[model samples]
Target: MTMTSPVALTERQCTLIARALAEPRRYQILKEIAGQGGSVACACMQQKHEVTPATLSHHMKELENAGLIEIVREGKFATLVLKRETLDAYLRELASL
Candidate 1:
């Protein structure tokens, strides 16, 4: 696999992504979201991961800031969706290394 063009990722974006994935739990959370099809309810993730609401919220925010996930909120419910292109670009960069 080849890495995407350097222009596709700024140094700051790469750093943010790396930081977001540095934590094991955060990485797992990302994987879970990716595996859950198009999108998943935060409540469902809470049940699956057995984490407190606040903890899950923190993880989600980290992923969102890294551009790895997108969240859509409707009133009290929030749905989490994986940003496949960002993850794919990151993986391609890793493969290039």
Candidate 2:
């Protein structure tokens, strides 16, 4: 799906992205999701990161708030997908400044 581009990023969006990424755990989570090249199950992330379900949920929420990732929940299963376009836009925006 198409997403907001660098030229389209608002100040609020940039701030959210920056804030979300400031967390080391979130950045590591983002890296893992990106390295996967597709969706990663929540269970998998928890296992890899050794985080509690509650903590993982909190971090995921922040990433989602920043538009950096999308989480799809089906029944008890949850999968996360990185929003590459958003990330690329954020990076481009930073470089442009």
Residue-pair clashes per prediction, in order, are: 0, 0
Model 2, range 1-97, lDDT digits (tens) per residue? 9974344689999999999999999999999999999579989999988878899999999999999999999999999999888898899898888
Q: Which portions of model 1 show Cα errors greater than 4 Å?
A: 1-7
lDDT for position 23 in model 2: 99
Q: Which candidate leads in TM-score?
A: 2
Cα-based TM-score, every candidate: 0.85, 0.90
Error of 1 at 24 (Å): 0.8
Candidate 2 ranges with C-alpha deviation above 4 Å: 1-7
Give the range of the ten consecutive residues with the poorest summed lDDT in model 2: 1-10
**21-97: candidate 1 lDDT, tens digit per residue:** 99999998887887878588988889988878898899999999999999999999999999888887787777777
Per lDDT, the best of the predicted structures is 2
Against the correct fold, how does model 1 do in TM-score?
0.85
- Reference-based lDDT, residue 24, model 2: 100
Error of 1 at 32 (Å): 1.0
**Candidate 2 residue pairs in backbone clash:** none
